[model samples]
Target: MKREMEDVVIVGAGIAGLATAVALKRVGVRALVLERSQGIRTTGAALTLFPNAWLALDALGVSHKLTRSYDPLVKGSVTNINTGDVQQVLFSEQAIRPVHRKALLEALAEELPTDTIRFSSKLAAIESQEQGGGASIAVVHLEDGTAIKSKVLIGCDGVHSVVARWLGLAEPVHSGRSAVRSLAVFPQGHRLKHEIQMFVDQQGKRAAFIPLNDREFYWFLTCKEENMTGEPEQIQREVLEKYAEFPSIYLDVVRHADLSTISWAPLMYRHPWRIIFGNLNKGNITVAGDAMHPMTPELG
Candidate 1:
């Protein structure tokens, strides 16, 4: 029997891949998403969907579903926890909403068709056609030895995308800093007024805390790259040690944290204006999001 072909084969099931699949489906295209992981894992601390992304989500018809479950950050003010000084207030006047990374992924995943995603399908290689004038095709070889052919192969795989490497794209550069993030449920009777605080000390290290709906507050700490590779327990200890001089409530928050919630990653990014991947001869192979340009969380 002849091998079957997919209209589109997207690698990775992160934000970019899922959103692209949903968009393609909306436009009447059938796309298959291949994810290396078994399922969506809520690992990141929190994510701020900038106004543009917010609008994009609205256009995609998922905005209401997301907003309904997440608390819009009606108020946000940056503070210098070191000296107890206020730096600049985005004030509740301007609307900025923060959502848990996991929640957003869950919602996006729910919007997608149940049969569209193939998990544990790591891309091992991609064979692209370079000759002839006919429509180009891409063959994606999965780790499990299953080969999938498609008219278009989109690499939505994250920083270490195999498709990117297969296409000769350079590796991602580290930003020389590492960040640790954690989310915790506020203790009973401890009412946390909704506020997002950023504490910058004299040493240049920084920490942030934001209150989400349901009495959950997200906290993060950024430090030199050297401090981030250790175990999570050590990282949590280092966080406590570094922020020891802050207000009692700040330290108290850490003390009461659910240590298991902490996660860390060394910041990495690709040049924004640069097109790491060459032009697709037949518009059959491309990349999006982190695969194209992974960057720090500058809220851009």
Candidate 2:
């Protein structure tokens, strides 16, 4: 195996990993990001970023770039699908904007030097120890016979993180709820308001749609599930059937949405109590993001 050394090594090139690297770069610390996938992640629809996320980006010096890229969404409302009652959504100087994941990642990455992220470098195992001077070091073994030694090892991998599993953190708990999301496109364009709209029924089912643009909108459906089984095509059909009674606009969007962009995810979470009592770090290894706090996307 080829041996390489670095100041820090981060696993998983998701939002957490790239964001961390960008923040570190502001302080002159460059980390080597190892992603299991072949390239940068480009999935998911629009993500709502509140004030806290913007504050974090402010510290990293990229908040202006994000603000420029995404339009501001200052309001959202909840409507009952059965009763057709709408609740007013008001904000006092608070603004939230929905930004595409790919654009956000690209914005963060633009601040760093070239080739900062190494693609397809799946981590297979890790070995760590205290050096003769009592300083800690970790050696990460990749699947392709490459060993990386670093003083700091951070895991930003998602819920199924290998690093979190090795740390003996409790397994993610099934929340009995699953979700499917897709970006709906309208060739003729839509007259929907720019604000976010959520439609829910009494059966604990939710269908929310947020406009991405005049021609494209991002939507998601969350419902109770017995298991995370089913083919993509089957799940797509099931989602359509589940929300068959929703408002006409929602129904039309779901029906005409791109099946290829639709995705299914079973919400899973580790208990917050375990994070306080469990080992968060051992030597030079630690975890962040979904790896540290995997939960339902309700508050994410």
Candidate 3:
């Protein structure tokens, strides 16, 4: 199907895509956002957005509504899951609060005009054309058989992005590690403080819990050299069994975790050097966020 030409075509409706679209709109640039999924993907996890993230959101006029103070960062605890050794670590007293993934997405979307996003429009392919007069154009193909041509194209399609692949970026390098994450809610309410807690076994098995509020906490477990994969229930079971030997406090977190929210994925990243020298864009097309730089969550 033929669609109207757009000024900018942004692939993916995640934070990066929506933020880009909103920012472009500030300068009288209209963007068409195409999301592969039927709706926004909410993983039921909380994210501690740093200062830079907030600053950018503010620039796009989205921060005022999302600017509510959350629990401040104080001391974080790291434990030796095997030897029972605990180390208390001090964190920056910054306002880096853990916000829910759904809330963050909704806040960003709210600032955008209604119908700015088109769902189930997964990118199929991209073709670059050398338009004369020093102007370039991109023809974007969607899985749904709709083709759109735009003067500029932005790739926020995330890791394993079709746009990134079309750009001939390097292959993803697996770290040979797998991670599982979930949120645990205490209906009776937890009495824990606002600090973050982490435990690591000698073999690189690690688990962490960050309190979102007094009644709920977010948690994740990581194991090295694992190729575990299956249904959601199987993934949750693997997470439970991997940290089965940890102290009751940790096991309790896993026990109380919402099984539906539990998820597992092997760690993978593009080599940093490749990212530094990688061909990010061709013609009028470029990428942002994971499509540009995807690092481990630990580095953040």
Please name the candidate that would achieve the greatest TM-score relative to the true structure.
Answer: 2
Query: In candidate 2, which residue pairs get closer than 3 Å at backbone N, Cα or C atoms, i.e. clash?
Result: none
Q: What is the C-alpha RMSD of each candidate to the true structure, in Å?
A: 2.6, 1.8, 1.8
Ranking by lDDT: 2, 3, 1
Q: Write the per-residue lDDT of candidate 2 for residues 177-294, one digit (tens) a residue.
A: 8888778888898887788888989998888888777777788888898343577667667776767788887878887776667777888888889889988888779999899889
Clashes of 1: 1
Q: Which of the two, 2 or 3, has more lDDT?
A: 2
Q: Is candidate 1 or candidate 3 better by TM-score?
A: 3
RMSD of 3: 1.8
The better candidate by lDDT, 1 or 2, is 2
lDDT of 2: 0.82
lDDT of each: 0.76, 0.82, 0.81
RMSD over all Cα atoms, model 2: 1.8
Model 1: per-residue lDDT, tens digit, 15-73?
89989998998899989999988998667767766677788888788888777776666
TM-score of each: 0.90, 0.94, 0.93
Would you list the clashing residue pairs of candidate 3? none
User: What is residue 255's positional error in candidate 3, in angstroms?
Assistant: 1.0
289: Cα error in model 2, Å: 0.7
lDDT of 3: 0.81
